[model samples]
Target chain A: MAKHDKDATFVGDSRISAKRIPNIAPSYSEFPGKSEPFWPNFLLKEWMVAAVCLVGYLLLTVSHPSPLTDKANPNDTSFVPLPDWYFLFLYQMLKYPWASGDWVVFGTIIFPGVAFTALVLAPWLDAGKDRRPKKRPVATGIMLLSLIGIFYLTWAANDEHSRLHPSNGGHSAGGATAPAAPAEKADSSFKPDAVWTAQTSCQGCHGVNMEGVAGPNLQKVGSKLDANQIADIIKNGKGGMPPGMFQGSDDDLKKLAEYMASLK
Target chain B: MLQKMYDWVDERLNITPMWRDLADHEVPEHVNPAHHFSAFVYCFGGLTFFITVIQILSGMFLTMYYVPDIINAYESVKYLQNEVAFGVIVRGMHHWGASLVIVMMFLHTLRVFFTGAYKKPRELNWVVGMLIFFVMLGLGFTGYLLPWDNTAYFATKVGLEIANSVPVIGPYAKALLTGGDIVGAQTLSRFFAIHVFFLPGALLGLLGAHFVMIRAQGISGPL
Candidate 1:
């Protein structure tokens, strides 16, 4: 290293003169034409934009509010499941005839996988100096086509959902129903006991109102199986129902069994 | 008084120059809205990051009350929404913030692509950004199941089935995600741990790399 001049004023503890070395690159040295300070110059605008976003976010929260629906019931085959809006395009793609059954991978994996891989490799895929969309026709065209495809798929998904469940008022993605609305009961007068409410896991295979879905209708089960038989079946899984599905203690199981037997 | 305190800390830590370096840095004029109205497009990335910060803060508050089990998960969310003060607001912020962040990220990606910012020296940054995007999607997917609602259960069922549709590792991947033959307690626990811990950690690390790369490359030149 060359000896520093005795009178040279260094920056901090460095031997190099503070004025000798430029802090930024040559391209950035002349700030007036191409750049500005990041602090008050740029950050002030950022703060303002952030404030607007915050206000808009608050308004959206207050207006619609987040939704909370009924607790999960694995046995509820009647319920139509829908993913959030962002995933809606892919969800719709899986419904295509070619994408179903044996070709399911085309929609779920292959197509999406290819698209994502292309996106990851986009920098190299269209490695050219031209930045303007007009100059980069291929890249721009591909982007536009993809956007159109996604938008169309999303719209179709919403349309299909509405067609399936017209009463649902069309695609309630964000507007989920309120929590714990009592599921429709077969016999309105017959009230559900505490055991029934707590052990709702039974509703997974059995119907929400014990009217039967995948399982046999238990509304008149007492006429078919006695309490002991029902308890036996509950303890040891019967037919399609899996073993140890009922998670409560033996006493709760007995009560549930007895309750099932009395449903007639 | 504040200046004196800052001076004392700066003297001990030798931080003034560092602070000045950061606070007085120059950003390309094209990124400034005053330079051109089109420059507003650059705001999307910063907005995404801003919403992400809000998400982290609100998500922390949610964890205080959220229970990650089959039995209590739904009920706990209910209690928080109905009973806890400002709980609805916090939860709502997170809920809406998730959607907003994705929207902003998509817009940011579009802006970058249109401007050809992903070309050449900035290619690595683009890859890192895409990783961050996928992590954000992962976060959205995992967080969707946290409430343990009927919609969540069946939607997740559909998602897992899609995973299972893949040829070779499909079944195994589904089994790992489900944690068993079914999407029950184990699945809930797995998703909860992943949503709260694994993906967020990955997201932060990726985001840090993304920012450092952007700083190093000094934002791509104008179109």
Candidate 2:
């Protein structure tokens, strides 16, 4: 193949502006001294990386299965919310004293908005042709600082979460945790009737085994509230518990209330 | 037989040149990992793409069992996890792959930035890649609410509240997202649509643009 002259003058057409086109660096325009076919060489390496990742992902899946907490309870206000690990940095940012209350938009919107915009416009923001990190002090410094900020914020978020709920175990960096098993203090001899089985939604706050979670301990609730009182609470909103949570008919609610009343 | 099949297709479709263009293209040594240890960083982008493919596949399988309504959503996910064959593995792949793809994409962005590969003519590609990154994040947000579990519920509630904290359009955005005063059946349905259809479609288009730009411009020169 004939080598093109590096400095060859190009004529511009009427439709296209010659000056508008950015000059391609020699490293990009000129053919490299050593090159290989993209097929077997580069693609082979890509496939290797992919294979390793897939295998590792499979191992992770089998070993630490994805967690499923109790079904969603819109009424459960006591449950603390934690975003996934990737969003922890942003979550942590919102907790900063300056970013809370009236100034939340700074952390919630402005900061993230500006950062994303800057990221998208990075190439134009740093328009120099110098590819070496050592030559681009400002760009390199910003990159390092941004990285440190993200890591630090994520760490702080995780630390705060663990501090708040030490018994739930520290937030898993992998974003997977074992299912939160209900406390094992329920009456084992209590047989679940049809009403109890149908009311799975109760488990969200009342606990899977009815030993209670965010809700008051219901293991022996029959010792206090009778079937009628329990039914009333289920119908009318009580402290922190939203009303009309029971989706069943009045008869079904009555049976569920009686069953709960019999728990003791 | 394979050779004959290839020749037959090449004769009719003129595929030989296309195959040659794809398979015989020269990769500059600077971008070739075999040539420089530093080029290993290039693998992050490809790995991110690989995980995205996994996510798409796993997500598709999940839809076979996933219900978008408030009533059946949790129950369906529970059924899929406990009953369906390989359900756990499939769900797990999508779960883990979501986080991994973000990590890989972030590392890829850092690599591109630090290497100064996003300069001049490559600026648009950087923008497209950034859009893809945001789409990936959007995918994560929408997918998080699908399980309808306690954590999903409260976490999404918090996320929406954060959106509601924005000025001017904040309350509107939250209303649009939640479809009402609260996160309910409509919210789940809307998020399901966005996660499975809208965002994925946008991601695919952006990815195509990103890849085409890379091919047209070729990989950036070594630092």
Candidate 3:
């Protein structure tokens, strides 16, 4: 090793330490520097994650209570947009250039997949000269591009700058304004032509011709109950339903409920 | 009987004074824990610790009402939220924190890549990180299914179908994930087992090794 330094004396920067890899035995270890805890040395990494997982699980159970609905309510649409926060990234993704179907899914799902794939393949990809990042242009370029890609998609999903977040985190005076248009859209589902189109998603699951797969058949559901009961089943949700029946709008629930009743 | 066995083993062991009795050596000045790579590891690792801790605290409370079986899974979640103290917020924190973990892991991996940290000596560690990444993804998959809600049910079904779409190993992977066919009792059990036992167990060792390797190798600097 000392001899190499002597040989490289002719080269300009002798501090070209690629890495101090050992060339022996079947295996080796790669531990980093020994540092005390970031704080007063109380909790370590694993313990912290373990703690968070425990707490999060507790909270979720407390708020929603598992098995709250029965039988995975397919016909019921009473529930609202209560997606898991982890999914909000994608849920938010759905709003992205949503009019363009393929690009939307790509921005949300496929893009992340490709980026993670690249991360996995990084070792095989950039196997080149110097050790420091300063020496590696190609590798650096890829990382910057990836960061930009993620930022773009995330922004595209929830353009907080848009009407979505008018207050920049402050509560809107009424906040009623946010869901009005969407609510009206839901109400539009009740129109005769709209009823035919909207009920198909229900038909695909509950029964196209009137039966049940994951939900009860809706052949004569309207005669059995009034608007409110049907609305509860549609909006607040029922057994086996995903609570997607209505999203922050009674108008949508009315539309959905009326349509389901019309199925007979 | 166990106490006697312990005593017998202790008597046979010659290890008494331990490392403190042997010698003490001070670390070099440059070998601070906050070295570039060490700081780098600390950044993500510290975040993982924070997130996992939140998961643990929230999960314990959830278990109060979280029935592992399919029959009551949805109901229990509702009960916890409506009945348990601070249940909704805690659950939300856990959930939002999960998304945070995935994001942090991605950034950490990127840091490792651009810095050339996974070169010759650190190849295997990089592989371990990859495994960690996949395990996290699996965590998302199985955890989502546990809710048994519509989005969870349908999305997971989509995910399972995708898994099953693989030409040769599709069925096997699907079965392994679902524990059987659809998201029934068997599937729920399988996911719970993976989420609680298998993934955490695997991660413990991987995480330790990952940190130790980071310590041993020293962090790679900025690209």
Candidate 4:
């Protein structure tokens, strides 16, 4: 090993003085340093901290629960495309004026690529001798700016998301608005629209053409029950029918019920 | 008898000195645990590891009941949440653990950066840490689609579409990820494979490298 410089900082066992680098801050070697055995002391502290954190995590898991929604429906278009909260900043970045369509590369690539590269290269680029924030202007400035930018972008994205979907979380409630009722008189031989009534759902229990399988026969249902009674059953459900089975707007349900009433 | 057994193992394995060396390693006296951010640096790192373990265990539990098929994926998750005992809590832990790990990793990275710990011989460690960070994000993105809910389906569509916007190789990458131009059963399968296999494998490898470097270098001293 080369002879150590009395004035220089220790650069590992090779004794290569680190003070050779220019623009370096003065060494703190003048202040006497202290050291301790890593065994019992540090290990015990680390294990205690780990135990505490484990307990905290268990508590959190016990206290909080996950949210869930209905099954995946490909046909339903009301669902708004929202990424998880962690990615909301990037998601919002894509919504920028220059970030949409042709200029998307700038947002997704150029900007992020530059920032990431800068982060990876910061040690080399900002290797000032000082570790204090005040002494390292460029490093501190960059860190603060990036932090502020991320937070602002995240807030803006969340705000824009909330704004885009004023009523719901961008989810258009399937049956929120009532449909315009038909102006003409009730047709005695009315055959409910299969597509509108979602016949497959009804056929699951009602059998082919409402002849009844698990549910009562609806072939002459009109003679036994009024339209309002049938509508109640469809909405609230009865013995066999599950509530919310009729997946349609209010008008569709009312029309289907009326058509069933005319079956007799 | 216990001491004899320990001696026998130590004679062959030579574990005692190695452990003592690790225990006796000196950190700079200036490392003040009382400092707020300095403490958080360690706290968050520990939390990140804890959450990673929790995620792995909970995810394994979920897989016991979760059917990854298009028809049953959503239904299976519903059953797990509603029917299986402690399923909701386990799933919740996994869900929240993913988010917490990301947050902790981000904070740890920032702490290292601002503290100038990434300098000198530690640069390669920083690079490895970045690789692990990106892998963590990959884990999050892939795991998001496993539930196969409407939110998961559409978010994935948008995510893949963004991948499609990358100049030349974008479309191909998107196709590789989604298994087509759209998010469907194939996309779900791809995500499941990536989430459980690829990302975790890559993460463990990168993390091994990262910890090895950190251990060899010791914690960087306060500036």
Candidate 5:
């Protein structure tokens, strides 16, 4: 039994025997010399680059202006809602006529879903030994194709959104055609902040339906005061309510008050 | 004075060995700054960290005045844009910084992929990187809804509607995200919670892991 045990250990050792070693490639060692030290060599250089980026970002912030739109109005169906540019590719994909009918789920789910899953599994799938680009055609090709597809889809989505919602023309980065000629202007009765104000500020105290909770029922507020008086109460705050809880322009406050007075 | 201070700390912590260990990393000397692609990866990594700092700072400032309610959300943003001092610039920094950070991340991923850096020992790093990319995308989506403008509302509506189409657990997923069948106060609150707390928390933790992974397995060499 002791002799058998000795033989077994020897066999295990023989499997990883050093006798068949291959010559190490000279390029693996000779192609690149030793690295520099960390502090001044790497960290200082990184700091210098970060400083440049900081300056550049500061300049960008000083120059570019951010966009803001009218308050949210769920009832306004004319408002063409668009997402940030990063999501434009997916948005454009969803607009494909083939995907639009009953197969909308394919565009929204299967396409993105499959792409993400494939991306995660790519390294495992393409585990070729060679590292050279020419030797690794599959990985390089996929990367190039994905890059082109994403950019093209993003451009297409932005173009479509601009064509549809030309009222937002000024903010469209490069594509400049005239605003859509027939887009109807919203009239005076269109209070964009009506439901918004009621839900956000009033709903908490006046109940979800504005029938009153902690505060008096605003259901018949129009019968009690004029739009101007109501606007004053909103701007000044009343009873337990804090002052200027409705933080908007004076004009927005007036519109909201008008919206409230008209509710009854 | 600085040397003495270092000595004082080093006596207790033995940081001299740690510093030596960090500085003694074996790298391919051919990894020069003249290699624009590699330099870009390094520069953008730094820039991404810087931009995240900017985002956090600017976002905190915005949160101070910006109301997240359905009614006051848009109005608060408008007020920030028009009424407050330098509010437009702060907001603009965050907006443009978000775009730049996303673009940089894509470029960094491309650099890594083309160079075959995700092979062998570095596979886990690539997976972590992919996680970072998706998390950043989530951050963008959740943050988009906080303003509660028509664009934000409708865009989110479209997005949630897409979520509603998944084969199984579709409705449950939609309800989970929007907090109900419709986008309202509950939806706004939930999105705010995610944008400010959950996503950021996950991002910081993941970022720490990512940096440690890179430090463990130094930058991959050129092909």
Candidate 6:
């Protein structure tokens, strides 16, 4: 006969009795404690997570690359600044203009700031003691959407092959990478805004295909340096290279590096 | 095979709670029944944990090719993306996830704060949570310079100058982080140790304490 009033607060007071709960019988009296018991459920779950992560990391670390690369070279201009795969989608997203003018910056930087601010303000927004998802729709909605966004974006970044599927015979404004080879002329179809977004620094020095008009041919460049070395050189700027002196940031390097790595 | 595959799909889709009945959902009469202890805490802790795990993975991967010295630090990152297979992916994940972690941790803190989840008996827990936030920022600050590239180099220099602006302790603090007046091998190693070893260890401890306090205090009151 227990019911929640208008405030949705329960009617009973003092001493929580699990027996009254339909899920657990009233006959149940004991609650699990830390020292008096076997492994706690939370502890077991935590350990399970830890174990899986350990295995995944170990496999990744001990592989052919050995998870360690060469030292930082300040002189390598061809280096790229790619970040981890999880961030690639956002990195990819930033290449696109969201609104006008500063959309890329807003999408990449300010959007994340808003999300963090919302997260920090979560405790206050949800003051009710209700522990049910159904009870807190806004918080619940934001949480679910955020998790989906994170997982989807990270997963999407992993699928490079997905990018190659032909959309139109020519290029579409859909992708960041140079469209399939047939789209060489399709690139010209891009709006003036897109063209004006950010000039490829590589084009300034290394020619379109890195044909060595300004620097050296990058077609065979992949053979010269490993992935890590290339990233360092691109980021650190070596020899005569001006070190991404323009449009340089963490995300910029990763995107540009991925582009250079794809050159081969 | 079809049935098994369906079951597999079901298992992954079973993230939503299906078993809790009406009474099982209840707390004390004074407590708000709407607050989901599982969802709130789980969302915060789970996201934070996942991000940390990402950092560890990406960070570990970076270490595979990274030289902890001033001279090699920059080249190492380059080597990872250029030569190593899928190294770009790993580095991208690490870099992005670091920013995401900082963002999520702050969000988790905000949830705790607005909920008044930090008051009274939980004030000490609140302090621990604050400590976790500070350490996360510390993680970002130190990790940013690891690339040893021009951006990292100059940004860090600006950063240390900001540090040195802290009146008397600024110079020493700057010295401690940069290993002299400038960034070099000592600076890289110092940042690496603080990032991988020192700060992470402290954060893990604080996180544990934060969780313990939550369980002890139950969910905070409704507004």
TM-score of chain A of 3: 0.32
Ranking of models by TM-score:
2, 1, 4, 5, 3, 6
Better of 1 and 6 by TM-score: 1
Candidate 5 lDDT, tens digit per residue, A144-179? Answer: 888799999898887776655455552365222223
What are the Cα lDDT values of the candidates?
0.82, 0.82, 0.56, 0.72, 0.72, 0.56
True contacts kept of each: 0.78, 0.81, 0.18, 0.57, 0.59, 0.03
lDDT of 6: 0.56
Best by DockQ: 1
Which residue runs does candidate 5 get wrong by more than 4 Å? A1-31, A174-264, B17-28, B34-38
Writing each residue's lDDT as its tens digit, candidate 3 over A1-264 gives 444543222224433223322222221123233433322232344345456655654564455322222335434343232233334354454455751255644644465667667677777777775767668877787788756755664455444423443312111221111312221112222324354345665554454444443455555567677666887766545654655533435676677677666644
Question: So what's the TM-score on candidate 6?
Answer: 0.46
Estimate, for each residue in B96-211, the C-alpha lDDT of model 4 and write its tens digit: 78878998889888778777888887889998888888899999999888888767888888888888888898899999998875688898899999999899989889877887
Q: For residues B1-223, what per-residue lDDT tens digits would candidate 5 score against the true structure? A: 9978976655444566557555555445545453343455645666677788888899999898888788788888888988899988888888778877887788777777777778888888888888989999998998888878777788899888877887787788889988876899999999999999998998898888888888888888756
Reference-based TM-score of each model: 0.78, 0.78, 0.55, 0.73, 0.72, 0.46
| Ten contiguous residues minimizing lDDT sum, candidate 4 chain A | A171-180
For model 4, what is the alpha-carbon lDDT of residue A155?
76
Which lDDT tens digits does candidate 6 get at residues A205-257? 54454444334445545556766677788766766566655466676666655
Q: Which of the two, 1 or 3, has more DockQ?
A: 1
Clashing pairs in 5: none
TM-score for chain B of all predictions: 0.95, 0.94, 0.78, 0.92, 0.90, 0.78
Q: What DockQ does predicted model 3 obtain?
A: 0.14
DockQ, cand. 6: 0.06
